[model samples]
Target chain A: MTPFDFFILSGLLFAVGLFGVIVRRNVISLFFSLELLLNSANVLLVAFSRLHGNLFGEVFVFFVLAVAAAEAAVGLAIVVALYRYRKSVNTEDFSTLRW
Target chain B: MREVFFYLFAFLSVVFAVVSVTHRNVIKGGLSLLASFVALGAVYFTAGAEFIGIVQVIVYGGAIVVLYLFTLMTMDLKNFGKEPLRTISLAAGGAISLFLLFSILYAGYRFYGGSIPATVSGAKELALPLFYRFLLPFEVVSVLLLVATVGAVAVGRREE
Candidate 1:
């Protein structure tokens, strides 16, 4: 496959993920969108790695994956705590920290 | 053959991603997100990053999506209710995403000019750099995972 094709696809995925993050109100859905965003970056990184004939980009993808996993773990825990406190996952209900 | 798979998976991923975002049911959205991730893994494989593709399937498809699903199981899905479907926010998001997509495509058109290099032996060749030159970062990622595990437990624990 062409690197350009990969990049274009990755860009579309990233854009869709971004739109989800912005428009979604449910916390769980937001998290899923975040994962899509991260995976899109992974796609680009691997494509670039192949394009440049270098392994650095792929190595970076590994690190990004690790960080994403950690972020998910922590983020879910926070969501659980929020659920317990407010009993809702809607972003609009998460106004306690706003003021 | 390769281009066909690429287009197929790319279409699958983008379509699923949009559905995942727009769907009101969180569990279904999460599942669709998983499908997108799997399609993305296939894209990586088609691009010749075999090891990364496998890892993508295992880690993202297997572990990460499972984590989200488990978290979803703990929540009351019935309480999700109807979303507001804000026109302004949707318009804003759509506009920004469209702008980004076009800009990226324009840049690619200008730079690549429809000529993309062929894929090399990424999986096999990545080994040396990963184990030798990038050994430190590799080990560091393990350490990071360990710390994340500990931190996640600490943060989630209920102290009475």
Candidate 2:
């Protein structure tokens, strides 16, 4: 497949991820969407690395993976804590901080 | 052959993502999301990013999705009552995302006319950059993962 094809695929994945983040009310689903968005970006980075015949973009993808794992760990912890205290995982239920 | 795999995996990823977001059962949603991630990894493979495709399948499909599923198992699924399916909000999201997708496709079509180069770098090529150039970030990420693990344990620990 061409790099252009990869770019288009990643772009669609990112758009779907964005839609999920905007429309999903559940925090966990939101997190899943966020990961999808990150992966889409990773896809593009790898494609560019290949297109330019450079390894820099691939290196960046490694760092991104690390950060994503960390984010997932911490984010899930926060969600679990919120669920414990509120007994609900809906975004609206945890909107006490909204002004 | 390559283009065929690309289209196949891309279609699967998009379809599963739609199902993931729309499914009412959170566990099923997480599983569908896992399928989407695996399909995306296939897309990466078709693009000649071998290492990335492997990492995507292992980290995203294996670890992250499993983590989400474990978290989902801890919750009461039946408690997720009637979701507020806002018509206006759904329309707005669909419109914005469709516009974004079209814009990206247009830009890609305009900018990427030449054939992609035939050089395909494997895992060995990625190792040098990971260990040498981006070494500090790599180490820092390890630290970040450690902290996240400890923090998760501390937060999830029950009061005695």
Candidate 3:
């Protein structure tokens, strides 16, 4: 398949992930959407690495994966902390700073 | 053929992602996300990124989803009340994403993704650049992971 195919896949996935982030109320779901966004970017990166006849893009993906894992770990910790404070995971409830 | 597998997994990835996002049950959503990741891994395989495909399945489908499920276990699920949908926000979100999708497609309409690879990339091929050329970034990422681990523990620990 062409690299265009990969880009189209990435774009659609990214759009869907962005929509989920905007509309979802749960913190966990927001994280899921975030993962989707990362995955979309990964797809495009790998395709392009192949496109240019280099492994650099693929190598970068390892960094992206590490970053994503770290983000998920820290983000989930924040969610748990927020949940302990508010007793709910809904974004509507965690608005103590919404002045 | 590679094209067939690529298209198939690509479609599956998109479908599963939507299902994961829209499902009311968080557990179901998480599982669907797992499916989507596996499909994406398959896409990488078909695209000739063999090592990336395997790593995607192991790290994303195995590690990350399990992390989510573990965090979910700590919270009581029954108490998560129904979130009422507002028509205005729904319309706005849909409109905005649709616009983005259209714009992205238009910008890349004439552009092709790139030519297909002559050789499939395996770990041996990938390891060369990762260890040599990107050694500094690799070390930095390791440090980032370590920091994130410590930070997560610090944030999540109960205060005495």
Leading candidate by lDDT: 3
DockQ of each: 0.69, 0.70, 0.78
Sorting all predicted structures by DockQ, with the top scorer first, yields 3, 2, 1
User: Quick one: how many clashes does candidate 3 have?
Assistant: 3
* DockQ of prediction 2: 0.70
lDDT of 3 by residue, A33-53 (tens): 999999988988898788888
Best first by TM-score, ranked: 3, 2, 1
Give the runs in model 2 whose Cα sits over 4 Å from its true position.
none
DockQ winner, 1 or 2 = 2
Candidate 3 residue A33 C-alpha distance from true site, Å:
0.4
- List, residue by residue over B100-157, the lDDT tens digit for candidate 2: 8888787777546665565666789888888888889888888888998999899888
True contacts kept of each: 0.64, 0.63, 0.78
Give me the displacement of residue A12 in model 3, in angstroms.
Answer: 1.1
Provide the DockQ value for model 3.
0.78
Better of 1 and 2 by TM-score: 2
The whole-model C-alpha lDDT of candidate 3 against the native structure comes to: 0.91
Residues A1-99 of candidate 2: C-alpha lDDT, one tens digit per residue:
666787787787888888988898989889978988898888878878877888899888878888898899889999999888988999999888999
Give candidate 3's error at residue B148 in angstroms: 0.3
